[model samples]
Target chain A: GAGVSQSPSNKVTEKGKDVELRCDPISGHTALYWYRQSLGQGLEFLIYFQGNSAPDKSGLPSDRFSAERTGGSVSTLTIQRTQQEDSAVYLCASSPRASSGSNEQFFGPGTRLTVL
Target chain B: SQQGEEDPQALSIQEGENATMNCSYKTSINNLQWYRQNSGRGLVHLILIRSNEREKHSGRLRVTLDTSKKSSSLLITASRAADTASYFCARRYSGAGSYQLTFGKGTKLSVIP
Candidate 1:
């Protein structure tokens, strides 16, 4: 079975530029999540999508950060006006469902973004 | 802000020795999951312990959860060099009929061969 996967394993952009990171979740996964891992820091939750319900954007750091999952599968995270502070590895994970006891997110290889 | 804090930041042990990592989190959680990451790659799920459960074991890995203290510890016995990696504890919480996870900074473990 295919696990979660991200595209453009690495990306480099200039400050004030915009970059989009893509994620393909596992088949039949009803829940997807995005997180950011900065240098020497923990994984920070970004956004979440479950089935057809409204996505949870509470973890998004700023208005420049946004994401959308289409057809309950693929998701794209867009960072507008990229800053050096946004340089980090963006990770995507998916799960069968979003229940307390059964949810175990499968992570992707992640896309490392560098803003200069 | 992150919800959990991992102690010792890093650990190094002999191949035949055991490795232990501890985590402390704020607020209540429904479950705590342990994950291993190698070389900054994707994380692999190791074990999950529910709040009601005090301890759980998986192969050479043993996990103990103390809700009273909001802390958890992971022990890997007879660790091999292959086990060297970053270990993280993710806290799961449910709100508004949805579940979310918050991860700790992680402990970097180095198993010497």
Candidate 2:
């Protein structure tokens, strides 16, 4: 009955540092996605993982952005050499499945990352 | 690139009045979903309409999809002050190997009590 949850609701780090954001999808969810929202940029898809495989990583802006899901449950998004442009709200979402019939994705509160 | 584009960047209305938002996309989609975000927090899924459905309703929310025009609209009837927030439309591209939902710029709605 629990919804998707993310850790470190807010994170502040200096430029050139690395940050890892965690996401715990709802129970039984088989698909997880990570997105970033910046001012005036709207929602940008970063990466998606289904079960244990990540089929799509094209949306990831650069090599610094990487995500991995373990045991088909939790996922972690890591930003390496974080730049000021990477400052934004990192969102996590989970869906029952990736099929067309189950297209709904429940989102989490998000981790607000600030690069100083 | 963002798939959906919301018009009337912002709207203000009195309570009990209706609010309508439109979204336009560039590609054919399998489904279109509406979401609401309060302030700067996470987004809440409002509803989804498949490509074959012309219109669908859930409570006070009414959604219409036009595949020929590549657009969609969300109508909220008798809105309340609590409904003030940002509304976004996301598109599920109609193809395999790329099912990511692309979101729009969003419309900021302000409801006065």
Candidate 3:
């Protein structure tokens, strides 16, 4: 009965550093997604993983953003060489059904990343 | 690029009063979903209306979709103070390989008790 969970509710790091944000999806959920929200930018999709297939990274802003879902359960989003503009709330979500249906995603408490 | 716009940007209403939010998208979609965010944290899905569905209701929430106009409306009847939060509308593009949901800028609703 647990919902999606994320680690490090808040993170503060200097520019040029790297940070990793973790996400634990609900049990039996095969779809996982990462998104970030910042002032003026709204919510931007980062990456998505479905089942064992390839992950969709189209929405990733740059090469610095990367995510991997292991065993189709947990996912980690890593931001390399974090820039000041990367400061935002990183959110994770999971859907019970993988794809091809009316997917309603359940979100987790986001990790607020601040680059100074 | 299928992102939409939510009207009013911000709205304040007294408890027990009805609240309405409008959204407009830029592309064909399979379905549209509404979500509520508290303290800018996780988004709690409110409801989903498919392209084929003209309207749907859940509890005090009523959602209507107009695929022809690529717009939708979410109306909350008898809103409560607890309903004060940021609401967003996300749409799932209609086609394969497009599983991502496009989100709007969101509408901030303040329910004054």
Candidate 4:
């Protein structure tokens, strides 16, 4: 019954530092996704994980952005050598897996990261 | 990088009024979805309409899709102050390996009480 949850609601880090955002998907959800929202970029997709299949990282802006889902439940998005441009709200979402195309994702509160 | 664009970047309306936002996309899509974000936080799913369907409704929310013009519109009738938020339209293309979603810049709506 619980929705997706994100940790470290707010994170402030200096340039070149590294930060990791965590996401806990809803129970029985097999599809997870990560996105970033900023004034300049609006909202953009970052990564996607479905079942035990390989994660989709094509949306990641750069090599510094990476994510992994362990046990197909919890996911962590890591940004290395953070830059000021990385400042944005990181959001996570999860949806049930079905072929009918009616799976609507439920989102988390998100983690706001400010890179100085 | 973005598939669609929303008109009237910002809008203000009195409570009980209707708010309509339009989204125009560049390419074909399997489905289109509307989401609402409050205070720039995580988004809440509102509704989804397939490309084949002309219109769909959920409570006070009405979504219309025009595949011929590659556009969609979301209308919230009898809006309340609680509906103040940023609304986005997302497009999911017709492909398996392409799991990415193309989102519009969004329309900021303020419902005044």
Candidate 5:
């Protein structure tokens, strides 16, 4: 079986534009997570989706950052009116279950977004 | 355990030498894990240690967890140039916000060949 996969390996956009990153979690995975990494901010959690439970948006830096996991498999992270600070590598990961981090997560290659 | 930053944010070591990275978090956790990242891309999980466990070993990698001290350490024995990468420690908080792992700042290891 294939591991997690993300689309648009690289994206460069002008500031104030919108962008959407996609992720395809492994089949049967019940938990999905999104994280961002930047030189200034380090690693920051963005959002999480578990089974049918309401997705946890606590880690989202701002309302401009939003994500959706449709059919409990594919996920999309949308940044509205992106800022320069939004330039970073966006990573996606998935787990077999929502074991509260007890289960190991498989990560995707990531989508590198550069906002100019 | 404190979840702020990893000690010696950057380290350079000889290929044959060993490398140790430490992480401390202030919050209670159910488990801890270490991951390796190359080129600042996706992370590869190295190991995981549960709260009830004290130590874990995988090949040349050894992990120690001290719940009482709220700290964890990752030791790579007899490192190689290929071992060069940024290592991060992510802890699973016990209660609220346990859905996601809180990652540390990470230690960048440069193994000199």
Candidate 6:
């Protein structure tokens, strides 16, 4: 009964650098999501994957941001040429499904990305 | 654009006292969920209230939704000091064959013992 897990707990990189954050969703969880949280702010949805359907990329802030959920179990969020404003905590969450009946998402310990 | 906005950005109350947080959203939603976060880490799901339901309760937490007003409220009874954390209200809407949640700024609750 492991929960969702994320890698790199903390990452510090220079501006214009690229970083890849990883997430491992709970077993059997078919819905995965990525979000960014700025200091003292709310979570900003980034992307979402459900089963084998096309991923929702409407929330990605810019073209530099991209994510892929391989094998429908693990997801990777990639931010290219990171900007100072991109510095924030990246969170991952997963749920049993995307249905309204089971939409409660379990979150993972986020990776704190600092673009200096 | 953020869909939900929470009121009273911060709140302070004594232990054992009740606390209330409110959220207002711009669009119609399928459900509203509340989450608690500590130290800016992962958020823990607190409760979820559907648009059809007026009110729901779990333990000391009570959530109420008013689809007509596009608003909801979360109340915690007999709160303890451990309840201090950031409480966020996320609006769940269905679109593009998926359900996604948009979160508000959140309310920072400080329960003083």
Identify the candidate with maximal DockQ. Answer: 6
Per-candidate TM-score, first chain only? 0.97, 0.95, 0.95, 0.95, 0.94, 0.98
Candidate 4 DockQ, CA atoms: 0.63
Candidate 4: chain B TM-score against the reference chain B: 0.95
lDDT of 3 by residue, B8-110 (tens): 7999999999999999998788889999999899999999999899999999999999988889999999999999999999999888755778899999999
* Tens digits of lDDT, candidate 5, A2-113: 9999999999999999999999999999999999999733478889999999999988999999999898899999999999989999999999997744678889999999
Displacement of residue A98 (Cα, Å) in model 5 is: 1.4
Clash totals for all models, in order? 0, 0, 0, 0, 6, 0
- TM-score of chain B taken alone, candidate 1: 0.95
Report the C-alpha lDDT of model 3 over A1-116, residue by residue, as the tens digit: 99999999999999999999999999998989999999644689888899998998988999998999889898999999999999999999999775657789999999999999
Tell me the whole-model lDDT of each prediction, alpha carbons only: 0.91, 0.90, 0.91, 0.89, 0.89, 0.93
Scored by Cα lDDT, where does model 1 land?
Answer: 0.91
Off by over 4 Å in 1: B94-98
Error of 2 at A68 (Å): 0.9
Alpha-carbon DockQ of candidate 5: 0.68
Off by over 4 Å in 6: B94-98
Candidate 3 vs candidate 6: which has greater TM-score? Answer: 3
TM-score, chain B, model 5, is 0.95
Q: Which of the predicted structures, 2 or 5, would earn the higher TM-score when compared with the native?
A: 2
Q: Supply the TM-score for candidate 5.
A: 0.96
* DockQ of every predicted complex: 0.81, 0.76, 0.78, 0.63, 0.68, 0.87
Q: Model 2: residues >4 Å from true position, as ranges?
A: none
Q: After superposition, how far is residue B103 of candidate 1 from its true place, in Å?
A: 0.7
Compute each candidate's TM-score over C-alphas: 0.96, 0.96, 0.96, 0.95, 0.96, 0.96
Native-to-model Cα distance after best TM-score fit, residue A23 in candidate 1, in Å: 0.3
Candidate 4 chain B least-lDDT 10 residues: B93-102
lDDT of 2 by residue, B1-113 (tens): 44799987899999999999999999888889999998867899999999899999999999999999999999999999999999999999887754589899899999999
